[model samples]
Target chain A: MAQLTFRESIARGIAQEMRRDESVVFLGEDVGAAGGVFKGTVGLLEEFGGIRVRDTPISEQAILGAAMGAAMTGLRPIAEIMFSDFFAVCWDIVANEIAKSRYMTNGQMSFPLVIRSGNGGGLRFGAQHSQSVENWAMMIPGLKVVVPSNAVDVIGLMAASIRDNDPVVFLEAKSLYSSKMDVPDGDIVDTLGSAKVLRQGSDATLVALGAMVPRALDAAEELATNGINCTVVDVRSLVPLDTATILREVSATGRLFTVEENPRLCGWGAEVTSIVADEVFYDLDGPIVRITTPHIPLPAADALEDLAIPSVERIVTTIHKSMNS
Target chain B: MASTKVAPAQSDVAQKIAMYKSQFALRQFETRAYDLFLENYVKGTSHLSIGQEAIAAGVAAAMRPTDWTFATYRGHAHTLARGVPMTPVFAELMGRTNGLMAGKGGSMHLTSVEHGVMGSYAIIGAHLPIACGAAWSAQYRGTDQVAVAFFGDGSVNIGAFHEALNFAAVWKLPVIFFCENNLWMEYTRTSDVTAVVNPAADRASAYGLESIIIDGNDADEVYEVTSRAIARARAGDGPSMIEAKTYRHGGHSRADPGKYRPAEEIAEWMAKDPIPRYRLRLLESGVSESELLEIEAQVNAEVDDATEAAKAGGVPGEDLLMKDVWADGGAAWRN
Candidate 1:
């Protein structure tokens, strides 16, 4: 019941699960002696030792393929790919191998595997490092994608992802890792395929994911004084999306403003926009708006990188414009 | 780059005939599958291992019933050698309800975990790391089970191949990297593609793994090498890299005439056809020549029956299309 940072929550969640289940193993580059480059795996090697908490070579293909194999053969391995950008190298492994094995086997195979990676922008690591590519995974069937916006969801979703039968890509928001938030004590597992309404409102719906939720909440806080009550929703697990909650929220408020770190076009926000137009077309009072990074590579320049991603001010302005339109 | 992996051993006549029979069955099975595929008997494509039957037979023979195996798209021989029934294999190829994937995975993606043929990868080099993981699982569980991966020379350059080799070596995983170096990477030869010497055995040193090159067409050679490697793996001596130097008799897939391959090279390999070579070897060892032909006749009959069963194997029920998309009750389908 104490405050834990997002990184701490993930480490604790993984540690807790590893302790509870003997089949659970943590394998990744620098996951052992280095305790993970981001420190999310800090105390695991000491607690679980080298056997359970393994340090693997820097190979995304092996990390994913081996994890898929391990999962197929009874053990539940939690594999950590350092950056979401590196998932590019593992496109075939994930899109084809891990994601399709279960169905290809006629449901005979169970891939109780979790692939965790650091995602999103704002620290200015540039194009190669800063990218939220959940869309790549969400586009694939059988692979569940989860983006935790806060420490609480991180712990809850991380636990649930590990226990899930299908392969899950758990993205830990890089910026949110240092931010501290209070989480419930004991085993806290949440349902996947459901979105949580962080703030309820009636004027317009603000659908945000992972890192954008905090910024969306910030925009909501500022919008409150202007008499624009915005409902900020965290679309936690994007694949098995919480369409019911989204449709209901959009139905209540005819305006929808979706936000995320990835490019707006063909992103999760656009998917949400299409869902709104397709399902509840007549319910719209204004144009569906998506506030996101432009379709370009993220730059190393700090200010330009900030310009590329969505911000609190940007989200608020978009909300106001959507309300006006 | 080379070692004494092919040590001499006393060969029993029964064991020799049994190995030869499996290879004979694979040659017949691939030929039948191809014939049916060309005549529109089965939908989609299939990568045949017609010339490389010995590698599969020997590898399957060396593996324990509980040991796992991940193979490439040209995995018919591997799967059949695992002793998976021809009905399911044919049923899968024909897109039938009782098929391995219940008509979903055609030919490129056939999986029969019950027989320990852990789904063949359509993408080359893709299954290498997965085999390492299975080995990792066995190691984690404290079991002596081993995971074997079979890929062609084309897959050696792929990232998974190198990664799996390194991971298996560092982790001391009980696995085998069985490279079926047919010389060509799909349409191109390995000589044209990469600069590494000894395309098979030379790559093992990079991963610090024990490696050997064997005549892939010889069932006894494949059996001897893989058995020793499998023994080392089961004894926790770590992974081994065995490159079986075989040749692909036909084109890479359906409609490929393989004109790109030189006629003389083809003739040379054709003369060294594994099935006949093994048959002659058995006869020379005083085993009955009629006995070998009888075995081949039985295999031919089995192939004919399998072909009939596969044709009658119907497509899955419509309701089944939605099944296995996710675990039942894991999440709700959009209403």
Candidate 2:
């Protein structure tokens, strides 16, 4: 019933979960006293106290490892790794320990941990702080990777991630943190591995995720004005991808354009394109197109960063090219 | 949970030494278990702690059953000393259905939750952060239980080690980072790679931690220092870094013979062998030779029994290869 930004929705989701379940706790740099660098956890510390809302040292490995241990023992820890790039510092713990714990111990252990981090390259945070590392997580077997596009989806996805019995990598796009939307009142629980179709059309299907989802919607609207009705689906979850929905949409449109902010090579978009091509090749009228950032490190310069990332215009162009080809 | 006071034994030094010999019996049990693995009765690579028996026996003697511990690849000594039954540990190494991890984890990755031995990781320095997390949990739950992480010197140089220590120091987690500086990281000498030559304790100061460099060969010294650190951690003082300066008589793995070490250095360390050193000390402190021989015979019989039991327990079933790949929820997306 109330309008809230994506960032505020996440904070409310975490706060509600922490209140309902005493096992839920927050840990990360600047998450407690400072309410996180982006203010997503602004008032949590004051409400939960230092024990529940902890300000951890700037050690990504320990932050993740500690979360894994706590999750295995009995606590559900929502750990924040300031930036997605810093995830590399603790990949071994994430991939080897947390992800594989449930399987490695033969179902004796379950890592019910939620690892939240900011990703994407819209802001000039440079190569170190920027870049979408969801593809790396998608490569891992046991992890469930989610990247929500708006306030409503963020709230829903965050709750699902917290409730998941396995480890989940929740990537919050920094560019979409301040974006506002009117979310429905009462509790909202969304299912994992499901996609949302924002716009319905028959001309082409546009698959996108995170910050790129909004851009694809805008592109769909612009194309609608010209009678080129394009369908836009927000792939909120990456690892357990809703291929069933994606395939049905692509089969109807006969043209596909996958959009992502990550580099083109081995990106999430590439994987989606491959899956669609392999499964529904005969249904497609033309070759699948992927609109993504160039395969290079993100630059600090504004103009270069803007040019490097996919835009609405790029999505529209990619859609037209796929239709024409 | 209320604190349980476990006072240190105040009997004569001879009695303490005898208790430690019982702890060594567990390590000897694992050593003989390795023989089953070596004789092809069990499958998978095995890393035995045949020579470094005192380190595990002494450290675990000072720890309570509730305290948490994690070890590296060469973890049989730590697991045995931490009170995991010899049968399951050997069965896990042999990949049996009744193994500690249900045949999912092999030699390098053995875990027993009942014993508070969380698990042993094969990756260098990877478990340091996990150990810190366990310690944090204990402190958060208002428990006085301490967490100990045992790693070789090679792990001290990894990024995870630095990150884990920095976090442990900042949060003052109840943890004891025990570094076994066995003078070598695989084939390379510690001097050839590490910038700090004194010991891992010297580097602890950089992280603002209280460090103690003890003669790891002397079991009594290890027990005394570790007991103090554990006590300090239980009292909420903070984490401590301990550099147990010791040596490995065997090679890094079963394949290598440790031919890289100088004969003179090996002889020098062998002269201060921990088992013999403790044995002599016990004999001089009023323990009779007959009692020592009795202890040895008892341990030898236990080792023989463990080996026989492990050999009788066969390898895991073929259908179990894909059993533990994921939790019982559902299949994970492979694409």
Residue pairs whose backbone atoms clash in candidate 1: none
Write the residue-wise lDDT of candidate 1 on B1-335 in tens digits: 46555766355778888899999999888888988887887877788998999889888888889998888888888988998989889889888887878887778887889999998998878898899999999999999999999888888777778888898999999999888988888898888987775575788888887568889999888888888899999999999998888899998888687889999999999998898898888888898978877988999999988888877877687576777877662334342
TM-score of chain B of each: 0.96, 0.91
DockQ of each: 0.67, 0.53
> What fraction of the reference structure's interface contacts does model 2 contain?
0.55
| RMSD to truth, every model | 1.6, 3.8
| Model 1 misplaced stretches (Cα beyond 4 Å) | B329-335
Error of 1 at B201 (Å): 0.6
Compute each candidate's TM-score over C-alphas: 0.97, 0.92
Which residue runs of candidate 2 sit more than 4 Å off their true CA positions? B1-23, B33-38, B41-44, B284-295, B312-319
Instruction: Kindly list the per-residue Cα lDDT of model 2 for residues A279-322, writing each as its tens digit.
Output: 99999987788898999999999988998999888877767666
Native-to-model Cα distance after best TM-score fit, residue B151 in candidate 2, in Å = 1.6
lDDT of 1 by residue, A1-325 (tens): 8999999888988987988899999899999999889999999999999999999889899988889889999999999999999999988889999887778778878899999999988778989999889888788888889998888888888889988887899998898889998888898888888899989888989999999899999999999989999898899989778899999999898888888788766898888888889999899888888888899988989989888899898888878866766
